[model samples]
Target: MKSRSVIHVTGAMNMGGTERMLMTLLRMKPPWKSIFLTYGTGTGTFDQEIKDLDGEIRTIPNPGSLSDHFQLFRTVKPAAVHAHTLFQSGIPLAAARAAGVPIRIAHAHTTADPSDKKGRFIYEKLMRASIALSATDYRACSSAAGNYLFAGKSFEVMPNLFDPKQFKRPPEAEVLRLKLKYGWTDKLVLGSVGRLTKVKNHAFMLDMLSELHKQGIKAVLLVVGDGDQLKTLRRKAEELSVAELVTFTGAVEDPSIYYHLMDVFLMPSLFEGLGIAALEAQASLTPVLGSEALQPEADLGGGLLYKLPLEAGSAIWAEKAISVATDSHKGTSDPVAVPPEEVLKHYYQLYRWKGGGHEQKTADYII
Candidate 1:
């Protein structure tokens, strides 16, 4: 019998949440021969995981050009094309539909920029465009993501579940502290793992840290991931007098070490479809504290969620964070019991066992 093939087209293999979630999904499903598409290159990228599973990896660029889509469609010839984020979803969807593939599903894992009425309109328009172009079905990490990504479109919920075994727990305090140059004594370790970009809202986290400092609290912030906003966020830390307390580790593929070192995980995102990093922190068994509900799904059985304003004005967000710090118990730190690998397995079983031919209206969903 011929084996079924699945292709996952994503931004890159730069170790972002969406990319990592794809990796975990590939790892959990040994039966599925997965293929990866990246816009950029990474050495030893998903090196072992993909190789060990005998999965294939490919690279291509969209450049917002027409030829890119044609090239992507012809290359893989997959039974299904699973685009990891909105930015790259339509390209593959158009390609797959043109190629007459059975399924072209898009997954929305990142929070979008929706500040003004016009901005929201554009967002809606983009959602509609993608829906009209190539997507067959829609999958969201949370219901919020579904509403945001495919308001008029239809979608299914397949929460981003994380596998705990992928994370290597740091030894109790001593080793990790010495490595990170942080003292293990009285400081509370508050960390967040994600790209230092506007969407992840590192700025908001910095403001929250500044707030913690003013309250005579000695908390340390460790961040894992890098992006365009890294420099600005670092400067903000200095301006807020929290520079000495913040450690930006750049981007590391495996965040379990960082997760192991943290006493508490922090997600100060302005908006989130679903916070996978929070799930990772939960897998690490460290508690999470955030200023807003990243997603109703992230708020599920674990983690603490607080209300936060979208101003990004620093002071307002800082003030909002204090209440969370004072009443820390209001946040759940033990992490949720759900396993991400299991969730992926369930999705595979539900979809593959049922055997659908195409996603249909799913493409026209969020656009």
Candidate 2:
């Protein structure tokens, strides 16, 4: 009996939220095999893990080229092509349609568009239409993403999966030693986890920290992740004169441990589909303050989560941050984490049902 293969299309399995979710799904140790298809090779930290799990990782050179997708589809002959990118998802999904893959899933992860120019907007609209037409099913990490990308199309909300056990561990002494070394013992330690990109609104975080300093509030921010905006954000932090108070840890393999060092987890993203980091923070029983644009679904029913408008000014956010940080008793019990095994069960069931009750679907699913 041959193993079933699923070609999961993604940007790169780097440190980004979407990529992290894909890694979690892969780590679920699903019954079927997986093929990770990215636009470029050797792009993510999970590449070695994918290989260790007997999964094949392929790169499609020139993602915009349909010929590249078609060749890979022919070679892999996947039963399904699940795309996780935004507007660009339609490209691979369309190739899947052309290749006759029976089960195509388009998973949305973000609510904000990177651009709004007229030409780009029209192109994205057409891309979304293609997604609706070519995809056999739709999935999103949150309702906001579903409404933004797959509106009017039936879709399922796939909760961001994480292993609760990983976060349940006590903080490492090394992490604590570093915190004490940095003199963060007495200061409120505000932390956030995400790429230092424009969409993440890291600049606003700096401004807020600057405002805190101006208000005579002693706080330090720990940013865990790196991106194209790292240099720009550092420059902006200097411009705001808060460079000394902000610590950028670049990329960390496991961010859950850092949550232990934070008094409050702040996500001031201009927009978010559903922040998995916020969920991770709550699972650690840490208080979270997010921009109003962040989806409320992240709040798993506890006083741990708070949201305020971006227009509310840095003073208001800093004030809320102080209160949340200083509270002796803030968050409720750790929010229940969606088990990776449970998520794997749902995905495998969908695969089996769609593949006609077979133990493993034949590659001929490409018809």
Candidate topping lDDT: 2
C-alpha TM-score for every candidate: 0.80, 0.91
- Report the number of backbone clashes for model 2: 0
State the local distance difference test value for candidate 1.
0.67
**Residue 180 accuracy (lDDT) in model 1:** 52
**How many residue pairs clash per model?**
15, 0
lDDT (C-alpha, whole model) for all candidates: 0.67, 0.81
- Candidate 2 TM-score, C-alpha based: 0.91
Estimate, for each residue in 78-175, the C-alpha lDDT of model 1 and write its tens digit.
66777775654665677678776666788877557444555666645764586667787788877777776676678788867668666546566654
Q: Write the per-residue lDDT of candidate 2 for residues 112-142, one digit (tens) a residue.
A: 7877677997888889988988998888888
RMSD of 2: 3.1
Residue 43 of model 2 has an lDDT of 62
